[model samples]
Target: MANYERKIPILDCGHEYTRRVLHGKWKIRILLYIAEGINRPSELERHIPQATRRVLDAQLAELFKHGIIAKTIFDESVKHVEYYLTDLGNSLMPIVAMMGKWGNTHIDKLRKAINTSTALA
Candidate 1:
């Protein structure tokens, strides 16, 4: 993980806290996918092929640390694990859904802005 410190401390605000908790690139998608029953790490990997397994594992660990998801390990001939949304994670679904809705609604404009920024960069 990259090591750095912000000159300014994070604000003691709910919005800032929420943003921090969901800060990683794939975290929101991970939460949504887990909620939709794509719980296994392998399944999640298949669903989000753009993210490396290492990054996904890091985000998953962060989510678990925040109490947003619970991990269950099954010991059989082969060991396997699955993730499920906790109560807190379930509560955040509506907000996530609304964000998705807003993005879809403004996709054209957002795409243009993103492309413009990417080109500039």
Candidate 2:
């Protein structure tokens, strides 16, 4: 049995559910990479060198649990694993693209604010 659970249940709303599913730091990036055909775990690790393999695996598990991604394992001379986005995940690409566009559009202001906050921290 699980010993840990949220004290407050997640709100039964579309916005809240979406936020819960996409809450992890690396999840969005993982989704984007998988969509771009960087599906192997090792490949993802190479692409996101700042993220530890454990963290990436955890985020991948979360994505899988939420049905946003599917995993495939190939058994040959050597085992291989790959991840792919699900239909639900594919539907989110436009939203993700728009978010990226918005960030690029406001990069100057956003970068300044983020750097300021980091400096303060």
Candidate 3:
């Protein structure tokens, strides 16, 4: 083995900002679900049944704060709220798709390794 030198890179780029936008555990998943045409909170809940509503709401709020998604309310006999991707959020679609592609491509191997590790522990 050879010694390796690692240097800290400056967090002065869009990379850091992107990381901040997608920081939460559920954020990326939420984005994916939204991109897949599930934009409402209740729909998101049904799509991701494992996540609690509170946690999903918190992530949705963060996404809104980051200007990635926007919430709209309807004026009618029954009030309704829905979220749609902003331009900034649309910009991330390609990146997110690429990530999903990579993950799906390697998921079997990754899952096997993860399961092996978990079993060992």
Q: Which model scores highest in lDDT?
A: 1
lDDT per prediction?
0.95, 0.93, 0.92
In candidate 3, how many Å is residue 72 off? 0.7
Best by TM-score: 1
User: Which window of 10 residues has the lowest lDDT sum in candidate 3?
Assistant: 4-13
Count residue pairs with overlapping backbones in model 2.
0
Show model 1 residue runs off by greater than 4 Å: 1-7
Q: lDDT: which is higher, 1 or 2?
A: 1
- The estimated TM-scores of all candidates read 0.91, 0.88, 0.81
Q: For residues 1-121, write the lDDT of model 2, one tens digit per residue.
A: 8799889986899988888889989888999999999999999999999999999999999999999999999998999999999999999889889989999999999999999999999
Error of 3 at 96 (Å): 0.5
| TM-score of candidate 2 against the unseen true structure | 0.88
**Over 4 Å off in model 2, which ranges?**
1-10
Give candidate 1's error at residue 57 in angstroms.
0.7
In every candidate, how many clashes are there?
Answer: 0, 0, 0
Ten-residue stretch with the least lDDT total in model 1: 1-10
